[model samples]
Target: MESRPSVARPFYSTFADLYDHVVTDPVGPWTEAVEGALASRGVERGTLLDAGCGTGRHAAAFAALGHRVTLLDASAELLAVASTRCPGAPAHLGDVRDPHLPGSFDVLTCRGVLNDLLGDADRDAAVRSSARLLRPGGMLALDVRDVGRSRERTDDTPRSTTVHRDTGSAVTFTHRSRWEDGLLVVAEEHRERSPDGSVDVQEFTFRMRPWTEQEVHERLGRAGFADVVTGPGVGGRWDRLFVTAVRRA
Candidate 1:
């Protein structure tokens, strides 16, 4: 394995406890898409691996549906949240591309992660490793950002926005974003308030590469996946792209 250049840890680790509240329906949309894909492909009930499963929401959903589930993530804090969410379900703390499992899975999922990768080599490694973790004929489902459409925006200035709300504990979110040189970069600021009026705050910056549909198809094919299919992505959003590929039998 090539040594991947170090990148800052994603927001998942920095604000794990607040993840479910901040991200809109993280698992519901993905689970629905994955279930639909599996049903269409006649795959029902099997070992499922959730790669880059930040809070284990998707894995928990599958486990609830009677499929044995395993989860992998790079963030230990996120993994802790996952373990609590899906008790008894196996979870490992590591990169999705380097999940240490004794055997391959019948189905693998990697949603909402590829676009955030900071390096091209890391992206390629993730694809190859996802392919490696699946049994021949198994399924791989994932989503990607619609980079093609994002490039349509002509604005060069960064956009800034913030949201603050109280639901038991006060929470605040600040975001600044802009597109630059084929990458969408964002600076995120988060603050959580205690009842005593004390506050915890953190800031992180992340970059996501826009991925075209054709580029996605080629990447999966190169990673040894066949019968690749693309369609509308999850979240009922026309912006993202969803794909399902089968490991070459």
Candidate 2:
């Protein structure tokens, strides 16, 4: 079977308003885990870059912990929400693959960003860019889909879920995913009905390339990072591969 080319809709732009509602990951625990890793490396608090900081969830958490947090994401809308959410934190609109930010930081978190880069070059560039943005011996933490686990538990069935909010608005999300050429392609549709019965529909397609543990180790090493350590999923999700590394001094 061949994969068809479709226009990539601006996902975050349309999904920003519904993000906090739909995404219920345990952000506090995830941030604490990353902070623990930093503490073990002797870093109490310093400059931190939240790369691909969607809606600044983790950024806000880091900021609340007294770290000087900086935000970066490709989506302007999401960045805006994050900026407002974490007031006083510097925000940059950029992609993690080539984040053009100023200054090397003491810590960088690129959570849930790498899998979105379906191409090898892009993924490599992202890791290298992360290294470039960190000072010598700086720490980096990120998560990606675990290729082996994900493949063993592949679910190709189409599914739908409807979420109703207390504000009298409801959104029905339908999605179908398949593996194509070793990459996961997901097609999603979101239909929202307002209190006045006005309805809006948005459709988008996204692809992800899960990484094997070996590949992650090799890539981090090639990107000028050392002391690479793979950890359990940040929020206890078995399908996620959490990793930490330090920039070579």
TM-score each candidate: 0.86, 0.91
Tens digits of lDDT, candidate 2, 72-152? 988899999999999998999988887778799999998878998887899899999999999998999988899877776
RMSD of every prediction: 5.5, 3.6
Worst ten-residue run, lDDT, model 1?
A: 1-10
Q: Give per-residue lDDT, candidate 1, residue 141.
A: 94
Q: For model 2, what is the error of residue 45's alpha carbon versus the real structure, in angstroms, after optimal superposition?
A: 1.2
Model 1 alpha-carbon drift over 4 Å, by segment? 1-10, 152-169, 194-200
TM-score of candidate 2 on Cα atoms, chains taken together: 0.91
lDDT for each candidate structure? 0.77, 0.85
Residue 118 in model 1: shift from native, Å? 3.2
